[model samples]
Every structure is written in C-alpha cells, then in structure tokens.
Target chain A: MTRPGFTGSALDRADPIRQDPAALAAARADAGARLLRMDGIDPVVGPDGLLDWGGLDEAPPGAFLALLGLIGGSPRFVALSGIPGGAQRSPLMMELLDAWPPEEAATYAAARSLIDWHARHPFCARCGAETAPIRGGWARSCPRCRTEHFPRVDPVVIMLAEHRGRVLVGRQASWKPGRYSALAGFVEPGESVEEAVARELHEEAGILATDIRYLASQPWPFPSQLMIACVARTANDALTIDRHELDHAMWVDRAGVEAALAKLPGAPFDPPPAYAIAHSLFRMWLDG
Target chain B: MTRPGFTGSALDRADPIRQDPAALAAARADAGARLLRMDGIDPVVGPDGLLDWGGLDEAPPGAFLALLGLIGGSPRFVALSGIPGGAQRSPLMMELLDAWPPEEAATYAAARSLIDWHARHPFCARCGAETAPIRGGWARSCPRCRTEHFPRVDPVVIMLAEHRGRVLVGRQASWKPGRYSALAGFVEPGESVEEAVARELHEEAGILATDIRYLASQPWPFPSQLMIACVARTANDALTIDRHELDHAMWVDRAGVEAALAKLPGAPFDPPPAYAIAHSLFRMWLDG
Candidate 1:
C-alpha cells in the first residue's frame, strides 16, 4: 500500500512563472535588478545543479528566481526543481512551498496554489485578450473584454479498493519500473468524486467497487489538482489495462506488496513516494 | 434530529469590488445600453412590486442593466431580487453576473461567490487604500501597500442527529413561528467540518453525537457559504436550548415529524420549504 506524505521525485518540476507580485514589485522597483519575460530565459543549469534564480546584486543571472509565498512565517521561493534541458522535463513543479513546520501545510498549499494559477492563466479565456493582474495578483482583469479570471483546480479521486484482506493498485508505464499505486483519475464535468473513482477503476483495470467511503483530501498542486481520497470494496477483480492509458494492471496481495516494498528495485512493484495520498492509503491499509 | 437544508436567512453582505469583464462588455455593447454606478442610481419598485430593468429603448441615455450568469440558456440579469426600503431590504443588491446553470450551481457558486467578493472587498484591510480587482475577480490587489485580498466563504456544518427512530429539530426566534429545522453553525477558522458538527450539537442542544458520517454538500450563496451535510448518532437525548443561538430545541419522533410535514404552521414543529436541504435530510431520514 502507498504511504502518506512520501514525496516522489517524478512529480517535482520547477515552475517558471513569477508568482509573487510583492517580489515582482520589489524587483521592478530596484534599479539594480533586471526584469525579464518568462520566454526570454534559456534552459541551463547553474553552478548549484539547480535551475538558478540568479545571484545577489554581485552574482550572475541564472534561472529567474521569483518569490511566491511565505510558509511558516518565512518567505518561500519556487526553484527550477527539474534538470535543465532534460528529455523527461515536465513543465509543472512541486516544491515544499511552505516552511518546515509542516502542520500548517494546508495554508501554504493554498497560497502556493493561487500563485501557480496566476502564472499559468495570464489571459482572459472568453475574449483571448491580455489580462492585467488585479486584486493584489489573486485575479486578473482584461482591459479589452473586462473579463475577470481566477485560478482553476481540477478534482481527482484516488482510492484504495479492498477485498479479501488486500488492496488494489495499478501501474502506468510512464512511472518508474515496478512502481504500482492506488487507482486514480480526475472527476469529470458531471460526475462526483465517488462516481469518478468507480468509473476509473472500471475503465482502467476492470474492477467493480461498492461501499465507497471518503477518507481524506490532499492539495496536489501538480498543475492544480485536489486529490479526494476514498476507500472502497471490490466486488470483482479481473486484469484488464486499457493499453492506451496503462501499460499493465493487476491486483497485488498486501503480502506481495509488502515483499516488493522490502525488496526495493528487485521487485515488480514499488509504491509512490510517501508524500502522495496513494502512499497514505497503502499505509492505512497495512497498519490495519 | 436535524433535517437537510433549513436555517434562517444566511448572512448576505459581501465585500467584492471587481466586475466581471465579459458581463461588463456585453452590458456596454448591447444596443440599448447604459451604465450607472451603484452610487448614482435610485432604485424604485414598480406598481407590480418588482424592480424593473428599463427596456433597451427606454433605458436612460447611458443606462445599462448589470447581468450576472445564465439561468437555463439565457443570461440572468440582476434587477433587484428584493424591494427597496423594505424591512428585509438587502444591504446590497444581488448582482446577476453570469448565466450559470443550476446543474453546475456548485461551480457557478464558486465563480459567483468570488466575483461577488471582488465587488465587496474594494479596499485593502491593512491600509484603507482602494484596491483593484485581480485574478479575474478572485482577489483584490491594493496599489498603495501591495496587499492581495481573497474571497472568504464561511463553512457551516449542518447535521442530522438521530436518537433511536426520532430526529432532533430546533427553532430560532428570528425565524417564522413554528418553523423548526436542522442544527447548524459556522465552522471557525482552524477547525474541520466534522469537529464543527460535533461542537455545534453539543453547544446548541446539550447533546453529544458520535458516528458522524458525511452525506452531501451544497453551495449556498445567500452570501457565499458552503454547507456540509452530515449524519450523527446521539449519545444522549436531553433537550436544552442555548438561547444565545436558538429559541428552542426538541426531539420529535419520526411519526410526529411526518404528521407535522403534512400540516405546516399548525404544529409546534414545522418542516422547511421543499427547496431546502433540511427538507431533503428529513425526507432521507423518514424514508430510511
């Protein structure tokens, strides 16, 4: 089973948008600081092996560093978390935007999420006009169309399907080899999270679930998603991966997963990082 | 036992100052258009008891009606849902900003709630300077001190507490006489809805509840609130009204409530209007 809060390296990428309006203002007003559009920057690793946010007044300009939010009463900035010019680069980045206190991660998550949204939705969708950041950068207003735009977050359902003392997980070929995790997918336009969980499992792995119950929720800002976690019972289990979406699908016994977790890379299955909700589901099941 | 969606009028004063760009554009471009600021107009109730949006041809030289969202397929315009100078006169007129359908009311509610927020929060709380609408009306940005303001939705836990076959209901002095319904209260900052339900029950009725289960949720915009519906088991049946918040509290057996539902305004306990969630909660319990 997955463990809660185990962060994976696969999901973290550096976002390139200047999210902190306050910092943007500071940078803009400072005679020594330079202002550059996101497109003008090149993809290159700095001396630190991380996407650089440039140096102090005396240092060289690296990746553009912009302050985003404050976590635990301290300023937090987004880093280019991925390798520069790497083939597997994902545009989205997941950083611990908040300070290390951790108990109040939800607050930092909310702040980081809105900042990320601002970076992406810079124009009015209805009129396709350039929008200006207003309301302290929490929203944007278009001069041409006057349309106001807010950040958007999609909801996805992640569930642990349990029966016969075992929980089910599936693997996508895109993930690291032998890494299997809970069944998850986005909630559709007209469906509830509960319905989405059942539908996703049915479509991806041919599993029918019943007695669904909600457990917890996590703010997953990998391009703005809210993961609704749930627990369900499997009425039937058969292997069927929609080859178009997944490379393989199966029902692994809890003991089998335990063995895999113990064996590391040698096993045919590994759970997602502990920070993910999937890890939490697996941990809850194993603890029980 | 508390029913589904019943409580007196929700707190309805909002603090947004931003306008929807698209709606503003449509208003400006309409053939018979005029625009008037909230401070410039004197609202009048017609003989028919409805505030009229003067026809396109008759609209004063620069007058345009403000529209919010779509109802059904047509745009729903804001023309005053209440009368001027009435005892229940709205402190603020509800603006029709978009044509949001009822099926997507939750999403529409979010949009409406935030847009309405911008309409109200025009000044920085920290510094009294005028703020501009930002992030498409999701927030307000202060130019003087650079502060961002976000829309706030108060979370309330509405619960159905069951004791054997009977359900609990309560009445508030401000409500219509004989109008009794579910128990609910606002969830404070830093508290979960589950904890809110448990605390509200104990405070208002002197009862303890266990077995809390989430049932459903609704977006109520009397002034932007997210109502979380839940079911709980009563640990004790003693009745005590915390008059600080409610007028009366009591436990009515299922049969009595069923009988009361059939005769509104006649019995000591009255069911809420059919459109309310409280009525649905009562129905669910009765059917169960």
Candidate 2:
C-alpha cells in the first residue's frame, strides 16, 4: 500500500531534549537552527516544493515557538499560531498538499497542530488560568492551577462498509457534484475505533457493521485530525439514510468503483482525491 | 483475540434522539427511564454483578444529564458528574471488572467518560465562556463564541518491540513491586498510530520500531483514553533506557512472559491486571 499523505516525516522529534531547558536553549542558539515560515497556519512552500524555512531570527517577537524536530542535527522550529478556523477543508490546502513533499507536509502538520493548540488554548480548561508553553511547546502548563494540557488529535473513522461485493459510500450536498467518498465521523469519547465505525454506520446509513478491521491511518492537518481507515461488512443492503447528514447514499459494485476511480465519463461518482484516506480505502478494496 | 476490556457495549446510543429536544424530554419523562446510580465516579454494583440503577427522580436537580442509551426500549441516563480526581486506577475498579458483566462495565465506562468531561470543562477553552451541555449532553456549546466542544478521547499507543526471541517491556517506579507492562504514551497531534508507536518506543526505551502493526483497541474511561495496542520489531537488543519515565526496561522471552502470565512464584515480574490493554497485548504476543 502507498504511504498516506502527510506521513513519513524524517525529522527526529528529539523528545528527550524537550524536557531539558539547557538542551532546548542550546538548540535555539545553534547556528543551524531553522524556523518554518508560514502564513498563519498555511504552509509557505519553497521553490523546491518543500516547507520554506529561515533562521530563528525570523520568528515573530513574543510568539510561542515549538521544536518541530531536528534534521541533520539542525533544530527546526515553528511559531505557535491559531485563529480558530472552521472545520472545513480548503482548496488552498489541497493545492499545498499537491505542491509539497510528503515528509515536509507531515513536518508542517506536526508544527501546525502544536502551534494552533497553544494559541487557541491560552487558558486552561481545568481552572480557567492562563497557560504557558512547556516541554518545548509540545504541552502547556496552567500557571494558576498547574493543570497540564497536551495537543489533541481528534480521531475520525473513515470506512467502506461492504456487503455482497458492493461498498457503501455517501456524499454531502455541498460537496463538488459527482464526488462521493466513504462515510466517516469522529470517534467520540468512550468508544473504540471499532465501536465508532459501527456507531457512525448505524447512525448515518442504518447499516449494522461487523468484522470491522483497521486498514491504515493518516494525519490530516485541517486543524489536526487523525483519520483511521477501516473496512467492515454489513449484514444487509438496506440503508436508512439520514438526509440531513448526507445528500445521497449508495452501494456501488466493483465495476462502478473502478469507473469512478478511473475518472471515466458517466462514472457513478468522482473518487476522493489521492491525499484523502478514503481514496486509499477504495484502492485497497479494488485490490481485494 | 478476546474482546479487550470496556468494549462490546449493548446499548443503542440513539443519536437521532440526541438532536431532538422533544425526543430528549420524552425519553426523560418515560416511565422506563433509568438513572445510573453512582457513588461519585465509582460504580454502584448490584447484587447480580451489574450496574445499579434508580428512577429519573433520583437525578440531582439542575445537574447536567446525558442520555447514555436505550436498553430494551427503556431510557438509560447518567448525570454529568465530576470532581477532577487524580488519574489513579483504584483497586475497587479492578474488583468491579472481575465481578461485573463485561457489557455493563462497558456501559459504565461510557457514562463515566461523558459525565466527567462535562464536569471538567464547564468553561470553554476557546473563549473562557461558561459552557452548557447541548445535543443531549454529548457536546458543550460556548454561549459567548458559540464554539462547540466535544468530549475528547485521547489516543495512546501501547506497544511491544521484539528483537530475536524477546519482547521489550518496562515498569514505572510507582507501580506495584515487580509489575511490568508495555511502554505507552499519548499520540500527539499530527502523527498517525504508527508514528506514535515508533516515537513512544524510541523515547521510552531507545528501541527503534519497525513493522508496527495494530493489534486492537480498548476504551479506558479513567478520564477517557483510547488505548491502541500494537506490536513492532526492533533491529537489535541494544538497550538505552530513560530512567526518568521508567524504572527498569527488559527484554523477556516467551518463557518469561508465560510465567508472568501464570503468576508463577519465580516470575520475572507481575503481569498487568486483566483490565489493562497491555495485558491483552501480551496475550496476543504470546499467541504468536
């Protein structure tokens, strides 16, 4: 299977040094230290189709800085940034993903999640006290209550529910016309990945899931999400679709899936983009 | 593989009803509405080794209440309760797991997670506004900024790194004497499960991971964590233990693991309790 987009980052997170103030200070002072350049949370891609970087002096004064990682023993830093954007994937992000190396995309993703988490959560949830970066910006500590906060990666389950050699898929009304993808929803607290898959299937399409299996995972930086991909079997073909959540829901056979995946004329629907884990699911399904 | 602890719940989450206020009111008013009885965050076990329950009238007035699920056409509800206890697993919880039906334990785990989240996050992190439960207590909405908050399920990677005939394991200083378990850490934002497994193994034991494979997942509701169990291979047996996080690290062969599992008198170390996902990871490792 192809390595999913926004993965396979080569940077060593160097967590051991994150705890040592002296080490972190030395890293910042190193002549080779590079700071990732960004436009808010968006990546600033270089001519070489990788993340743009500059000396540590380029960081905005007083902005929080987090160690992205180390490459060739040079410290990589990103200034923490956030404006609390809506949970909508943008066309610019798609373009950025296509224009950068997968590893650089992943490195940017890590830095973005950490920085945004710090910016959006200036106060602690436990005691409503102001927070400051700690652990080299991997975590935050509340000064008043001393409550610690870690950057959260919300888990979302995207899956193909199959029955009788057909796969279940759905598309929202607002999406590009003729674009359909596997159904997905956030894995709520207190639910396992399998349970989330089953719950989401049942709630959105009235499909009872069985034999839920983990396929692969991808880190999506639309404000930091971990997409857990899976495939499951459905007991029957019946779907009680929730129209409010989906514009249409269908079970497409392998031939229809192939046509869609190939982007042929008169295809049932357009496949999800290559960067989406759902596309990988369809590819795996085709192979099976 | 055996079902991990805190899974296989039987209740219908009834998400559709969660969105309708009239339906929520109807559920609460139903004569069959059942309130889970709890002594603080701990379970109140019935004589039949199931969760004890009472009528809706037992709920604390004006306390946040969540619809847990529907069981046999009856409404099951849990009052959102929290006192922010330290993250310590009590001995009583172990006894409850040993005594109760697994399904009931799962149900209780779900309720505890939801209720505790509501209690801990009364103030919104986005704007520090006082938040109120919406969507049948499944989500909190900040009145000031209208930013919605869903309960977070922190994903943690627990893995065994094998080299030659032995598997890597570690023990925390505060654990019961001679008790060892898989090295685990929270999956930070912007990393896949595979990345987390590799990062955690390297940080905790200096073992570089390869062929990281997901075994299974378990929802642990001690403040709501999703334990993703995995196994990976290490290239060599060379050891570099970080004493700050782990008191001791070792590579034990199948014989050593078997003896530990059996509670033999001369076991190298005590196996983690049956309720921990680490225990299930070891069991799966042995089967291979």
TM-score of the second chain for every model: 0.66, 0.96
Give the Å error, residue B286, model 1: 8.9
TM-score of 2: 0.97
Q: lDDT tens string, model 2, B116-221?
A: 7877777777666788899999998888888888998888889988998799889999988899999998888878899999888888887788898988988889
Q: What share of the reference contacts is kept in model 2?
A: 0.63
Off-target runs (Cα >4 Å) in candidate 2 are A81-90, B85-87
Q: Candidate 1 overall Cα lDDT vs. reference?
A: 0.53
DockQ of 1: 0.04
Scored against the native two-chain complex, candidate 2 gets a DockQ of 0.74
Give lDDT tens digits, candidate 1, residues A5-30. 31211211111113436555554344
Error of 1 at B174 (Å): 17
Best by DockQ: 2
Off by over 4 Å in 1: A1-108, A260-268, B1-213, B217-263, B266-288
**Model-by-model lDDT, in order?**
0.53, 0.85
| Chain B TM-score against the true chain B, candidate 1 | 0.66
Q: Model 1 chain B: which ten-residue window has the lowest total lDDT?
A: B8-17
Best candidate according to lDDT = 2
Candidate 2 collision pairs = none
